[model samples]
Target: MKKVSISLIVISQMLLGLTVSTTVSAAAKPITGVNCNGGFFVRTPDKHIHWIDEETEEHVQVYDKSDDIYAMAQCGTGVVTVFEKQIDGEQQYNAIYSPNCMNIGSEKGLSSHIYQGKEKINKIDAKDGKLEIRFVNNTYLRGETCASVSAGK
Candidate 1:
């Protein structure tokens, strides 16, 4: 069986300037080339959607930001495009758009870098636009594409 799972450690201190870094996964960032809903969490260079393929040094997912709003759900629950990574890898959580409340911040960009300041977890398939994710908590987050969502597949 594929030994995979999601884990996060978020620590906080009430003291001012004592910001404790939370152990979050990199799955919590806006889609690189395509804009989600209508927010530039990460600005796109020019009108084209660029993707840095580490393997072939290729470019472009060939996406048009004009077709934004991939997926939408009512609270901190819904499907998201998870660029999964193997265990002992960089990140593991995939962030998506949800009503960001003061208490519940499920919206993307809540953490600047998704996997920044995070250690690897138990999983496999290090890549973007691929892999599966299982949230430890009851929170809803999944790996899926916009096309499948629209088609109701």
Candidate 2:
């Protein structure tokens, strides 16, 4: 009876080790690539999005820029693109718009207006060739896009 009790304890320990190993392996999968400049966020080969400051190589997970909207809008013909970065549980944004709003003022720059306050994007609507964004504070910004929004799943 003593030998049988020891064998059962050993078997239980082995099973527990196997369960832990399986859980750790699944959680170890990393994010490969994320492309911030390509209008929509593009994923890299490693499944992680790489956010690098052009001036500084610091790994940035969230970025807010206004210039990106102008460029994407220009390419999409009157469509503006806004990007957001989640920082400390809040959303920071950079608004990009058409050439029509370019050279307006420093206060109206692509990154300025969107980051003016503590707001983050809540929903994205790319329906009927229009891109509509709803903010966390219930404000809405709408733009007409010649191209569609393709966020890679």
Candidate 3:
């Protein structure tokens, strides 16, 4: 009985060591991709979008400037509302501006490839005193984020 007990204890210790090592390595490795559920978000107040710079972590509010998606709280989710110029009944959207909060995971950085092709109007709707706009993007981190905008804002 003594011998059997010692063998079982040794075996359990070995398994525990293996598990610990695996968890450590996994945590140390950087994550490449993330789902759009909570990867990022947008807080809109008074017709401005709040953004946190990925590298600097600086609080920036440039309204229509597109940035990176490093973490979930770093603005990787939701549809960032941006106003575009209406040209002949078509909204002209310039790249590097007004991206739906979607973050693509990779080794280097986030992927900003969410384009509407020939289709414009990034899920925009204007009605009463408020407007609900959902910018569109491609890949893993695309979601809708609605906010308050004053009339003519």
Candidate 4:
């Protein structure tokens, strides 16, 4: 009985070692293509649309711009509201920009390629009150961010 117990213990130790080794090996490998340097835009915000720059991490503003911008927050999730424009068109959009907060992972750095073939991305600079919609060849559509201080809210 004692011998059988020792054998079971040894087997368990071997299994544990194998499990640990596999986990370590899997974790050692790096994740690739985790960042979205550029892509296509689906919907562009206009006068009726307002959003918070996840970059600012606070404050909401009307995202009316044309520039090479990245709205990573839009890809994740956030709040949306519908409002009217001067042209009497109904527009729907997030009242605030709560982006997924994309970190420039693994990629070398932001380059012209960052704006390549981009269909839609809303880049916001809360500090400067600037917003931009970026597209091909690092081209952009820009606008002045609305100056509605959060203190008023």
lDDT of 3 at 102: 34
Candidate No. with top lDDT = 2
Candidate 2, residue 138: lDDT: 89
For model 3, what is the C-alpha lDDT against the true structure? 0.36
Residue 61 lDDT, candidate 4, scale 0-100: 30
Error of 3 at 129 (Å): 25
Cα lDDT tens digits for candidate 3, 1-153: 999999999999999999998776544222233222333234342333444545555544434323222122122233332224446765544222122343222111222323322234344433332334343552122234222222220
Top candidate, metric TM-score: 2
Models 1 onward score TM values of 0.21, 0.31, 0.25, 0.24
Evaluate residue 73 in candidate 4 and report its C-alpha lDDT on the 0 to 100 scale.
28
From the highest TM-score down, the ranking of the candidates is: 2, 3, 4, 1
TM-score of candidate 3 relative to the true fold = 0.25
Error of 2 at 77 (Å): 15
Query: RMSD (Cα, Å) of candidate 1?
Result: 20.9
Q: Return the TM-score for candidate 1, rounded to 2 decimals.
A: 0.21
Candidate 1 local lDDT, 1-153, one digit each (tens): 233322211222233224332323322343443332232233144323333444555443433333233222222222233233334754443323222211112223331112211232232221243333323443322335211221111
List, in order, the clash count of every candidate structure.
10, 15, 7, 18
lDDT of each: 0.29, 0.42, 0.36, 0.31
Worst 10 residues of 2 by lDDT: 63-72
State candidate 2's TM-score: 0.31
